[model samples]
Target: MLGTICRFWRDQRGIALILVTIMLPAIIGFALLAIDMSRANNLHNDVQKGADAFAIAAAAELDGAPDAWTRAERAMENLVDNTTRFSNSGLVTLASAGSVTVNPGASSCRSRGNISWCFLKSLPASDSSPITSSNYATTQAETLFVQVTVTPESFSSIFPASFLGGSNGLTVGATAVAGSPGAVVCDMVPVFICNPFPGQSLYEVANSGQFYKKSLKLVVGSTSWGPGNFGFLRPSDGHGYGETDLATDIAIGRVPECVSARRIYTQTGNLTTKVKAAFNTRFDIYANGGGFPSKSDPRWPPAPNVRKGFQYASNGNGQGSGSQNPCNMELATDATRYHQLTRDTSFTGQIGNGGWDYTGYAAANQMTSALTHFGSSYNNTTNPPSRYDLYHWENTHDSNGNVVPVGDPNSLVHTQSVGGETGVPACASTVGDEDRRLIYAAVVDCSDSYVQSQLNGQSGAPPAIGFASLFLTEAVTGDEVMAEIVDIAGSRGRGTMENFVRDDVQLYR
Candidate 1:
């Protein structure tokens, strides 16, 4: 028996089997832990991706509306609730568990009072306090930042680790900031128009008809230095190069002030030459009753009747064979002509009465009537009436049958007393010079102290308020250009917040 025991102890064949049996449970436990770790990592990545998508979607609607916060939160929740993915051997669902914070006018750093300096990289030392959930809301109109935290629904690890004091739950979070980093405007005009409705939103401005009925007086020659003056912009250092250069720069959207140094020049000579050059750069004029011929370049002929020196006459009496007077016809009355005019590249996707509002057209006619037939009886009976009043002619009654006075006119133009030669003349009377009728003008906030100071060449200029498409109904006479504000750029719809001129949205952090 002793000899048999000695031989068995020396044997190594079964020893390997014994060791394998002893280590099998540990190996299986380690494999399970590795798989759980990979699932956790994948969950973290997927949650981050959802957070990023949610932030971008919500950022687009942060246009300073009263319900911006509500919309953003809803967007984040919808994204999380709808996303699902496979993890380990089973599927894992993702959802927003904690609060979704939206910080508007609040930067990734601290407030700098300007949109350009609201990012983390451009922040100054004085404004370097870290942004916290506690103090994120702000009234400044600069940047928008959002933070989202996510927790996966009750995930159980394959291997329980109560003995090793490990938890099975996991949570992840992400943050993003987005805002306009200045706009890159293509074919932007160099002219700047002072905002007529100060301390009001773009929506209010549009609803009030001030956006369509008013004409901006171009600051020229020796106009008084005030808010509504029109002037040439010196976008570069020193005085700007003369007329031709200015037009070329404006056509190509090369105004340096649009990006950095923007200065307005009011005392320059050759104002007519500069304005004409700018207008011609955008339009192709046909003189003496000529019609447009098809060309390779589609952007030519910015407006209808852009050609000058043509007399209005009935069909067979005038140059073209049309029902009404095609030469000097009112575009609003003639639908066919209006459609043809809107086919121009500039009028694509524009707003109002087929991209040209009736309010502006009526205002133009009123200006013409004021100049042509001054002190005539205000005719409220005509279909397209000849009067400065904007109120509907039908009698309006209050609670009692007494005819109530039409409340105050929505626009300043309507309220102005109509008499004398109030109409502004065409930019040029000569043939092929009517292209100035449609000029793009920047609508700037004169109410902002910074903008006002900057206009006078003071230090620290605020960004321009926005841009508008102005229809130069008539020419520049003395110092005024009788133009109707047709459309304000960057306004998504009739009642939305107006974005800054040529501004684009970008992710900062």
Candidate 2:
């Protein structure tokens, strides 16, 4: 028996089988761990991608929408709850198993969600802060910054805990920060006008719902600064710009940043030629269409009514009422019939009862006629197309004695018949018409001190309170260029910071 035992102990025939049995569980455990690790990595990458997408989407609405924060949260939730992947060769569903946090003007990451997963929380404020990335630290009220964090719940590993030190659960997270650094407007007109309404920003005016009711007459040649005064802008050197360069700038939509930064002054010279060129460029009037004469048309010149400038009598007669007057006589010809068709009407039902002078009423009437003609010619489907509606008047009483404005639900201006006729004609859509004007004049704050600063170039360029789109109401004369305030472009209380006409969204961290 002893001899048999010794021989068996020495035998190595089945020793290989024992070794295989001992190492098999450890090998299987390692393979399972690798598979779990791969799954965790994939989940990490997917969550990171979701966070990035959500942050960017949220950043876009920060300026325009009232419910920007809510919208952003929803976007993140949607992505996390919908993504799915495979685990252990079997499909595993992924949900919003983590919390999401939002910090609008966050200086540093702090506890925001239930899960201790804050975005950039460990980063010191000095080294990594949202303000550092955002150039406008002073305008924090208008600027918006966002942070998002995604932490998935622990996922069960396929590896058996008994073999591998109970490493059965895996959790991963990702974070991102996005910001909207305010707006930089391109294609702005060089002219600046003092804000007529003091102590109230354009945003305040818009919010008060009174913007549409106010009829402001901007005088182009006036030197006295007041609520309704306007003037042509000159370069820093006080010299007038070339007409061609000015027109080209309007067409291309922006002046050089360096030039725009310099102070602008009221033009001293007669601006008749420059005004006509600018107006023609905006309306494409020199180009052909709408029963109007093209630049190529030979019959264009004898009829001064066909020109885009202020429609004044060449003989120096303001109203041109006399039969011999060129303005009054030009309307008789067929080529000038469009001009005749646009004459203002009165409540007595008499046509041509109104004078075509430079008065505010004349300007308003001229604008209406031009818009109507343009709409009839260019717009195929809509009558009095929205682009032509430039006037917004105060509220009017209804037939039932209740207050009502035309297009009440969407009306921006109140319209009432004054002296048996409406001062401003109604356009199909006021919102659409507001953006039609090609010339935009900046509204500067005209408060006593601010005005002085602007005049002396001490305050740099005067802070633009708002912008007004100009609609030529009358043809250009020697020194007189008449236009109506068709639309106002600006926000209330948007001081110092550039207006948010356009926005750019991006990831800061």
Candidate 3:
């Protein structure tokens, strides 16, 4: 028996089982801790996603309206319905700051979760300070951003922390900041028009027909232009907009870069001569040189209704040789034959009294009366249909007065003139381009000190109060760009903005 006992004491057969039994409790404890940690991590991710979503939704409504904060709070309460996957899986409740008039830190809403938010004029260094109601109103236009913070979610951990002398609960918090980075307008022409009615907003004036349908001469001036003067703009794109590039943009309608409607970079030097050839391209007049595209190039096609005064040149003047394309050369001036729409008679320096030769124009173009063209709504004898109104009607209808599909080729409304010049475009058959005659321009408040300085050749980026859509009535004659301000760009509810103002929101942190 003594010999057997000695052998068993030294035996190692069950030693492995004994070791595993001793370490089993520790292994289970570690596994439980890891599971709890993973749950906490998952909860954190969900809360973070929720915060981001909440911030974005709320920020979209802070559009500088008097009721912006109120709208933001409503959006937050109604739009968000985030749920947590871990940590009891309850509906995430967000605390509301009651009314916009309520004190900054006094949130009347509180339940399962809590939320705190603040309006910021700019991105804050830290999210500790919140904006007051009065302060927000004072700086409403500047307060274009919002910061949001969610209270840490606290829940009981499955792992028994008693084993490690710790509490059996975990907490996770999240923060997000979101708002509009202002609005950006895209595909604008490289030109700026001085606001005609500086006393009132552009939208109000435009909607009220203060400038619409009235002819205005956009003159080219390097320095010290009067109240109604208009000029070119320098593209903010660092790719360098030379005379040639400027000419190309004038013809093609937009530069590669989109400029801010709030601020416009005025062209410093005289850009008058280079653009004449480019502007003539829309009227089916292509120059032989100056980097202008050839007549056959599809990219630089003319407007379908290129009804300029001069006809195709009978004698080439050594410029246009081919009979097939005698239209390339500029015909000699004939006061009797050359047909330019007569300017409005009651004219000031650059502005017209909205009374142009509508009767003669209708007779010349063979267009129907405003009553026949636009129906009974616009048959007022006092206010005749604008040239822009006629242009649209002419494009949509064919020679036989039948409705033609937008892309389909249609016969000219009137027979070609004896000199070969006509309203119909010979270079391009289709009028598919986006209103080739409608040019978008920034409307700057020339009365503003900065804008006045800019006009006087000072180095300053003047803020554009709005953008206007000017219809190119005639080709650029000398340094004057003649047009009628048919309407202002963008929606006219609040004010006229750029043609394409992209308003969006994003998460900052």
Candidate 4:
């Protein structure tokens, strides 16, 4: 028996079973540890997704409104409903700080839900770094970004705690930061006007009817412009853009550069003659000479509606003989039927009151009934809708394109014509960027000492107070841009100007 036992011990046959028995526990333990690690990784991924979704939702509502933070919090709580799987709990819904005050420096957190977050006007260096007082946003306008932190999810691992000499529970967490990308505006017009109402905030002035229907005569000069005065903007490249370049940009909408919403640089020079000549192209009036595009060129097509009060000579008025250029004849004074609009009485300098010649203009255009459509809002003598308002009304209110006294068979559909040319475009068959008559210009508060100091030769960028949508009332004469402020950039009263703004949001971390 001893000899047989010694032979068996020396033998390798069936010895593998003993080795397997000894290593089986350790192998199973490693397998369980791997399963636990996989579960933790999956939980982390889910938590990260939840954080990202919540942050994006919150960032979308930071549109400079008064209750932006409150709205952001509400959006985060109500919008996202992420549930995590692969945890010990089987399925766990992500927690949120449901009801918490948004204190500036301190994070808004809730222990019950176990979520923490904060608003930031700017960004931090790293996603893991804590938000501090210097970077936190206190007001709605400053609340441009949001940071979200999900509470750690604890789950028991399948592995035995005593085997690994550690706790069986594993924890996973995630964080995300989202906000609006820097306000980069593309295809912006290279013109800026001083804020007309410096006394009131941009929101207040936009909402108030005081700016509506008001006429502004924008002039070009190297001198310092006050409120209502207008000037040229330097492209972001900082090149010395001359009149030729300015004319091309104004006429064809060939933008020089994209600009930042926070600030803009100014161009110094008197771009009067070229500016006027180029601006008139929108009115279907190309100059016979002076390098202006001919009427036949489709690239510089006129607006669909060009009803400036003036007559032109078919023979290029001694310029390009027999060329039929519309810019041949100078626009007649208001005394003549072919007249430019007179300024409003309420404002001084370049800014006009809402009081424009609505009655006389309507009568001349045979749209008197359009004014009556306002019904009690039309005073006939006072408080009449501006020509810009009437222009849009005429465009949409008439489907068949009839003018005034709609149902009447005698009322002419082709009633809007002045100086032998109809309101309808005659230059080109197709028009591009149909808002040709509309100019989206930056409104800067040049009255500010800092802004004033930056004018003329200075290189400093002056902040734009707001963007104003001005309608070209008539063909530009000399250096003056005869326009009416129809709408401005803001939440209060955004009309057609909303089309120009290109705000986008993205994840910072």
| Most lDDT-accurate candidate | 4
Residues 1-509, model 3: lDDT tens digits? 99999999988898889999999998998898898888888888888887888789888876654466667778887788776667664556544435343343543212223676767666545656543444332344455767677777877788899767998876788888788654456777788877777666676686786777788877765666654677777765433557787777777778667776545677755645558877777777766543464566565677767776654544545322345563454443542344445556676778888877655554544443422544434432356667776676666666656676533456343444334455666664334352777787877777666568866442456767656777888876566778887666556633334336666788877
Instruction: Please estimate how well model 4 matches the true structure, expressed as its whole-model Cα lDDT.
Output: 0.68
Models ranked on TM-score: 4, 3, 1, 2
Ranking by lDDT: 4, 3, 2, 1
Give the TM-scores of the predictions, in the order they appear: 0.51, 0.46, 0.68, 0.72
| Per-residue lDDT of candidate 2, residues 1-509 (tens digit) | 99999999998898888998999988897898898788878877766776666566655545423344545455544544434354332443433334543345553232323221222212225525443333322232233655666555456778877554666665666666676543434556555655656677666665664443223444442334655455444444534455555544443344433222113343422344544444433322342232222333332222111223222223545433344322222221221212211222221211112222223332333343333322234321222222223232211222233444543532222222121122222211112122223356766666657454455321244334446655444333234334444456533432223342444678866
* CA displacement after TM-score superposition, residue 287 of candidate 3 (Å): 3.2
Residue-level lDDT tens digits of model 1 in 56-100: 655554544446555555554564343434443255444443553
Number of backbone collisions per candidate, in order? 7, 9, 0, 0
For residue 223, give model 1's deviation from the true position in Å: 7.9
Q: Candidate 1: where are CA atoms >4 Å away? A: 1-31, 61-139, 142-156, 160-170, 182-184, 208-210, 213-216, 220-228, 231-244, 251-272, 280-305, 309-438, 457-460, 475-478, 491-504
lDDT of 4 by residue, 23-91 (tens): 999999889889888888888999999989988998877765557777877887788889999876778
Worst 10 residues of 3 by lDDT: 104-113
Q: Model 1 residue 176 lDDT? A: 48
